[model samples]
Target: MLTTTRLDRDDAAVLVDGAREKSVEMGIPMSIAVTDPAGHLILFEQMDGAKVSSIQTAIDKAWTGATARKGTHVYNQLCVPGEPTFGIHNTNSGRFSIIGGGLPVEVDGEVVGGIGISSGTAIQDLEVAEAAVEHFLKVQANQH
Candidate 1:
């Protein structure tokens, strides 16, 4: 059987807190979601004043990142016109997204989970998600 790192509740909480801090620093409310490598929801949060519509989008972003094993922006580049993955969003029952703000969480070079943020501009969301992922990596490194 294949073995890989998995995200536990404490790890999920760390990611959520990191994302929340970045969102607050940026003065942007956001919806954040974390998911396991298999795309299973591990935790989710919606900041006050965040748009309700972003809840689902955040979850879907995390799911896409975990399952696809790539940042959503990478998918966006691949799905552009005349690109090899053009129209790839049509797969996975349309659950995949090519927008920014989705990122895989890696531990020792293996993806353990994914984080996604929404309810702000794409850049803001990506920044928050990236901040969360970076914090998680630091925490994991210190644990060793």
Candidate 2:
């Protein structure tokens, strides 16, 4: 049998914390979601005043990032008309988001989880998500 690694509660907590801090710094209430490598939700947080509609969006973005093993913003480019992956956004029961704000988390060069941020502009969401991943990596590096 092959050994595999997945994010646990501690890891998910760190990711959420990172994203929340970034959102606060930006003065934007946000919905955040973290998912395991299989695209299953590990944790979710909705800041005060965040948009209710963005809850599911955050989850879906995390799901897409985990399963696809790439940032969802990349899909925004490839999922457009005439692109090879044009219909990718329609897959996974529409859970495959094609917008920004979803990012895969990797450890030791292996994907461990995903983080998603919403309730702001796509660019802003992406910024927060990036902060989350960066924070996680820094914490991991310090621990190691």
Candidate 3:
């Protein structure tokens, strides 16, 4: 038998809340998404004034993060032409995001979930995503 850890609703909430706070601090409304280890969405939010087009982007980003088990930004470098992972973004029905702001959530060296943010620049979205993950980890650490 195998045992695994996964994020629940409360955990997803923490990620969303953290992302929202950071987005507000940055003066950019954002779309945030949280996903399970399997890349299934657990929670999502789009702040007022956020771009409507970014909603699907956020979800796809989370999907990429969780399923790929790597930050989406990492692919931007590797997914270029002639690279080994070239055309990766074309796979998974085009759900593999090469842009930034998609991050896997790991606990005890195991990926438990993913977080994705959008609506600002890629760098800005990445910053908010990082902040959200950091906040989630801190909260988890304090609870245990």
As a whole number from 0 to 100, the lDDT of residue 8 in candidate 1 is: 98
Each candidate structure's TM-score, on Cα atoms with residue i matched to residue i, is 0.96, 0.98, 0.98
TM-score of 1: 0.96
Candidate 3, superposed: residue stretches over 4 Å from native: none
Error of 1 at 11 (Å): 0.3
Model 3's alpha-carbon lDDT is: 0.94
lDDT of 2 at 36: 95
Off by over 4 Å in 2: none
Error of 1 at 55 (Å): 0.7
Q: Write the per-residue lDDT of candidate 2 for residues 26-69, one digit (tens) a residue.
A: 99999999999999999999999999999999999999889899
